[model samples]
Target: MRHRVSGSRLNMPHSQRVALMKNLARELFEHGTIVTTVTKAKELRPFVESIITRAKKATTITQELGTKSTGSPEAMELKSRNLALRREINRNFNDRKLVKKICDEVAVKYLTRNGGYTRIVKLGMRRGDASEMAVLQLVDSEEKKETK
Candidate 1:
């Protein structure tokens, strides 16, 4: 019936789909944006959001704990705490770095705002595959200015 089915399969197997999503996420983090099919963008939104939300929560916890500020006795301790948090969120260094960047640079820039951390702009269709294309980017003025 496919009634309760969630998430698009993109016709790929389970393991391949996970791998594809992970790679796309890594690339998106590294580039601060990416252009892909609209379907992929939709799927990637929640996946990426979960990571950002975790980072945000971690940041909030550190802030509340008064541990991560500069020129403090607990600064080194907070650094270790952040490192552990990063490792928990993403096992690899590249992914960890991306998460940290997203948390410190991207998320902080939008702290005053609510959710909807990303935007997907449709770019018509691809020439060869005729697939729908869209650009997904972080919702921040600095990124907009940098790209423009």
Candidate 2:
């Protein structure tokens, strides 16, 4: 009767699972890339994408909100949206700077694109645990460009 569970439990309790996800996401956002077990990457993919999607929405709203008066209702609405998203993101990320980075820079980069903000590349297995490993990372990176 495990149907429709929607996500891997990773054999962890709810709080540990949430902590693992938050830490993985924070590292991924701060470094723009991370290598972990394939199972974990698969799980983190959608989680990271949702955050990027939120960022994209903020970017779109800000772009469409240009020239509005700061005190105007429209401007206030946009500000509220920004604050709300920030607060939502802050739940996963303890550092305010990382949250700002995602909203201001990372999200803005993917504005033209629809989705697929993160990419996962299989990196073979870990020697000790024999777990299938992979690199889960942001798509747009200067280092990725240089490697190309």
Using all chains and alpha carbons, the TM-scores for the candidates as numbered come to 0.77, 0.90
Q: Please state every model's RMSD to the true fold in angstroms.
A: 4.2, 2.3
Candidate 2: regions farther than 4 A off: 141-148
Candidate 2 lDDT by residue in tens digits, 44-128: 9999999988877877777767878778898889988977877788878867898889989999878877888899999998999
- Look at candidate 2 and tell me the lDDT of residue 4: 75
What TM-score, to 2 decimals, does candidate 1 have? 0.77
Q: Clashing residue pairs in candidate 2, if any? A: none
Tens digit of per-residue lDDT, candidate 1, span 18-114: 8888888788777889999999999999988777776776676567557446767677767677667767667532555676786677667665556
Q: What is residue 123's positional error in candidate 1, in angstroms?
A: 0.5
Candidate 1 weakest lDDT stretch, 10 residues: 88-97
lDDT of 2 at 100: 85
The candidate that wins on lDDT is 2
* Angstrom error at residue 59, model 1: 1.2
